[model samples]
Target: MRAVLNKIRPKEKEEVASDLKDVFDNFSEDDTINKAKEKLEKFIAKWSDKYLKLSNCFNEVIVEYYFTYIKFSCNIRRMIYTTNSIENLNKKIRKATKNKQSFEKSSRLLDFLFVIIKDFELANTDEISSTCFLFLGGLRHNYRHGPLQEQQS
Candidate 1:
């Protein structure tokens, strides 16, 4: 989405992002996996010509292994598809580590970093019970398929 948005004029980017958000917002309203898949396909088709990056990204999000490999739970969380958690983790670790002048040893640095990670984990505890995939709200676990692996380019 960011890739496609970067192509737009700066003046129209915010409005376009908001429009895209509306389309994504509909996912939570869908009551079943098929309905959510339908919405995703519709969204891909609607933006395929205009935003190839978004089309590919959404396609990647829906796959046989993705549904099969992840042990999803009812405790769904919003914006799970975004890289916010991973990025936030990086930022928090950097900020926490930067406070120290230097580590006496690598083990000490590792221990400090571990504490930072644990603190972040405790803060975002939703990740422990949240669905591994987006649009998984109220979705059934009937999509089990093949083993998990990296998506081929």
Candidate 2:
């Protein structure tokens, strides 16, 4: 979508971009699939007059899959809608493999990817570790105190 947006003439880019952003802002506020579709339809009607190509692109391509997000929670919807996390991971993978022309086998490529993913996981383990400790402590406290209260009663 950003690629398509970039194709707009420089003179019209800012206005069109701002309009599109406003449409997305409205769409994101919708808690239901039906409301989201309504918002999109309204945006298409409003913007089509000014940016026919951009509006048509959304109507023809993007709206087709818009309902798929309805089953997901808002947090997941936000994550899926944004490209930052996946883009960052892709950037890291591209940088790591940029110098290599080709892998000897598919397994070799998979091995490299596995190592990269494992390294990222290990780098992020501190937060996970602390959460795990807090969870385990709560469980231990409950187990120790729960039986004692039951026996006294």
lDDT (Cα atoms) of all candidates against the true structure: 0.54, 0.56
lDDT of 2 by residue, 27-146 (tens): 244467666677677766765676667555665456657556555665456555666655765677799999999987664665566555445446655322222222222322222222
Q: What would the per-residue lDDT of candidate 1 be over residues 8-94, giving only the tens digit for each residue?
A: 678868866776665444323334445445655775677567655665555555533323212233234243445677788789878
- Would you give me the overall lDDT of model 1? 0.54
Number of backbone collisions per candidate, in order?
A: 0, 0
- Candidate that scores best on lDDT: 2
**Model 2: residues >4 Å from true position, as ranges?**
3-12, 26-30, 97-112, 121-153
